[model samples]
Target: MRKKKCTMSIPTIIECFQMGMTSNEIALQANVTARYINSVLQQHNVERQPHSSWLRRYTVNENYFKTWSASMAYVLGFFAADGCLPKDLQLVSFSQKDPKILEDIREELQSTHPIKTNPRTGVHLLNISSKIMKEDLMKLHGMSPKKSTILEFPYVPEEYLSHFVRGFFDGDGNINYKKRTVSFVGGSQTFMEHLKKRLERYSFEPFIVSKEKYHRLFLSGRKTVYHFGQWIYKDKNLYIERKHLEFNREKLPPDQIKDRPFKAHKSAIEARKLKLLYYYNLYRDFPEACKSANIGINTFYRWISTDEEFQLKFNSICNEKKI
Candidate 1:
């Protein structure tokens, strides 16, 4: 049988991706299935940007009040990082590959909304479509529907700011033990700058790096990384365990570190580069190689493009294999 043709043009899909439309939304607008939209997006290697909440539809929840609480702050922080309140859709959604994180979010919100998983991509999406909850988030948290570039710090109580930041960090932060860097990546310049100021208020030094379309706030050096980790995890049992464990590895005793399989930094980030090189040689096991090397697959590919030595070594290995 002849293969079915794609109805939507590649350019249109790219345009929608640039507009921060989710694959499903793009599919809906373009008269295609979500899977088809995703396939085309993958072909173009388009990065999936977060959705803006500007056009979200909702009924007012008169009972909602602007109260400060740890749970509310955490939910706001997590939403600021990875969630979306699509205007016309009348829904607030958070999607992550990890189901555990979604479960944590569900429990935090104390909501009955069902968690839906996309079988093809293994991404779990938590949807909140209730008008009451939508209005509550908007009024209490200063969450605007169109909050991408205009996002600012949420109205978190002073004492619970750390909890909120912790939730945001868990959603969008990255910790590189070898490099001793703690980074938060986002597209909102205002939000990032506010975060820098907030960290400064807490006596934590953070610097921001501007990329083409996004910004990254970096907290470097052992002192800052250690301090931030200790502060954020002080409450214990309220964080992403894997990240907290990795963050505190440096403070572990030698025996304890060994037992926990923690590798101390060798005064160099080159250690990670070398590991990446080793993984690059495992050509047949591409996904597992990237996982083992503790880097994203796209990042591994980018390294091959930018690093001459890495590219040369990979090419040489490929030549030797003659496959």
Candidate 2:
């Protein structure tokens, strides 16, 4: 009897090949002869590896996350910010707009897993489908399938804390050279608070502001931003290039550095006051404004009575609305 001809598309055949399926396996699944599958793979310049070799095509150090090293801490931190674990899959995936960072991470992890691009968003994705890796991430690092909102700061060793923070910063933090600010945004309030506490140990007075669904920890002004750059990049070689370059650019003049006496800093206080004023203007009611701004009613009243500048600004805004 004659064999059925290969009916699978070229892309499907290539995909199966890339997925570590042997030609015979693809042929069997597609209901075609093995020779037909081999020809299709050859036409696409895809090599036909033995079944055992194909199974080992994508190799990684499964024990990479088990020990605490600079690379391990950094990868863990980055994962906490950007990695995702599917509820039904034994996989951990990372998506980044910059493929360079993903490439760096893959190299650091010694992973040969292919990095695929999302055509729709032009994002690069690296998915490691290993049960051991997934289990280690969950059991060792306290990672969950959907960990954004409930993520707690992991216990990174003191010596490797900077590396961990830098990794997390590379994933979720931003630096504004023009504004002279460094900020971290995270979905978990607990995580942000813990991060803020850790940064405080380095003399960074970061302030946390609650957003609608997440929290933002911010360090503003020239002195803090410059020092932050120095702190996170100290003795660290693994970092996102663009951000590192931006941070290493010319330092601002000493005269431009403002003194920060309070923990919240002058800029943060001004930002909070502005946020309160914005809410007040939106609602035109003091109590409602306080609620929306996430500030206590007592705090609003105290700001009005204690700070002459804030009080004047509030009065001006209220007068402008009346007119």
Candidate 3:
């Protein structure tokens, strides 16, 4: 009881974690710092996991994903270093004994590689697999599942599954995600139903944005977007690429073999599509909107000023007539 008074609140710590908040992320979100975040966690005896250091590290799962879900508390990996996908993506069961479906899965994997005919998995991975399937994705991803650290938000609603964020991340132009998640709303059953229904059917990738933005922007609270091609999901429920996990050349389960095989990142992936979607729909203007949204103008400028794509995205949204 006495400990609670001297240190930060437990909800505050946990909420940050659930939101896919890293030490740097938490500092920025909660108006603190990396050291301070560790200090607080220490006070509470909360341990720091690999995904704990945001904007600084990147890696992925070892075995198949275990109870992976696209939501809070789930950790994802980003491309910290410039590297090609693992060889497994390229190593299809070319042998005669290979199952046709598994061969096709391997063939599909081959094309997504950045290198020609050299199939590498990808820069990141997400543990969306739950129970058995998750195990598969993790095995494919090559890392441990990020533990449910802590998530705390006093006012975010539960129904809205997704949205967008403009200038709330880091300086390099990348941003973290905080969506409603597949599990939180209905867990794997509902998530699988929706995921299966939408595969290849839509043109846009369903992106995960800031939960706080949805509450203020869309009145109806319909959070989630259906996107395709260049735009992809990140943040809590996604993975970029990971480290320290092992991979054993194995075959995909017969059931999953026929399912839409997860493909690697597309060639020339850019922020253009995401920007268009954001500005045309979810983007709010500067200054007043920034203040109200709790986003600083400095942040807004930092992102747009340095990145050409970001500027183009913003300018196109605002209808710049050109100077």
Candidate 4:
């Protein structure tokens, strides 16, 4: 009597592989031995990809991208600042002038990939080829391979939004006390617009200005910069110290901060509305605007609820001016 052959389909095996299942695991699910599963996969011309040494050395945690985590926020910020996704390849890369930054990012990600340095360019790069990560980033954050002009604002977790923003600011933002500006520069117009909208939520009046090929999100005025610096630097653990140090009030000239024309009223109801308008035009965040205007949180809420004209003006300004 002739014995029947194992009946698992090639498509099933491929699906299991795509899901990051090992051959043995796929075999268990299919009620077959591991060898049979590998044979089936091989017969279908699906060669198992070789794992990188870095990947082999470390236990890859796929759960990191399942939600908005502190590590994830930091990675996104680093990506926005100095990382690149090659459209033609499966690799995601981070390049930095400081190798330590790359090392910190690698540690934060728990990535096992070895850092590569280009002597000519004087930049250290950490490259990773991770399909699961790519999919997660694309699905969760809409990050595509050729993500330049197409980059959009991520749906960040509310509690960790500041962390993610800090990562990006650390990567690409600059604090110029002399110029009285804290700015972020990027090549994507879409990214710039999204950043402007996000800043509005924080009451930050970020101005978008085009310079050469890239766009700049600029928060000017000492009060505005000080408030922004405070918000972003609230937790220094996740930032580049050199960049964070520039925002230290004591380190900067007190005369410059004092001479600034921003005056706050004690009641801060009407003042909040005026500041909101100022920030709205600049496309800044609401909370930061409140802080900058010295409006108490409770007062801001009461004014918003009781003041009808204030509401109308706020909406009107946002509709007419915000980009």
Worst 10 residues of 2 by lDDT: 47-56
Give candidate 3's error at residue 196 in angstroms: 13
lDDT of candidate 1 over 105-171, digit per residue (tens):
7766655556777677888887765556667767777776877777878767778888888889988
Candidate number with greatest lDDT: 2
lDDT of each residue in 66-165, candidate 2, tens digit only: 8999888889999999899866445678888989999999998899888889778998889876778899999988899889999988889999999999
TM-scores, all models, native as reference: 0.59, 0.68, 0.19, 0.61
In model 2, state the lDDT of residue 89: 49
- In model 2, the clashing pairs are none
TM-score preference between candidates 3 and 4, better one:
4
lDDT of each: 0.68, 0.80, 0.30, 0.69
lDDT of 3 by residue, 1-323 (tens): 33433234556666455334566755665555677777777778765666543312322222222333332112211110111122212111111111232223223232221111212532222211123333343354332222111111211122212211110110011221222111111112322233323432432233322222121111110122212101233332222222101111114343342212112222112222242334333445455545444445665666577778767756765774343
lDDT of 4 by residue, 1-323 (tens): 11134445677667555434677766776677888877777888875775313334544454466777776787787687787765534456788877887788777777777787766788888876676776777787777776766678788877777788888887788888765677788888788888788888987766565545787777766667777887776654566777777877435564455424433432223433655655555545667766665667787677669889777766776676545
lDDT of 1 at 278: 51
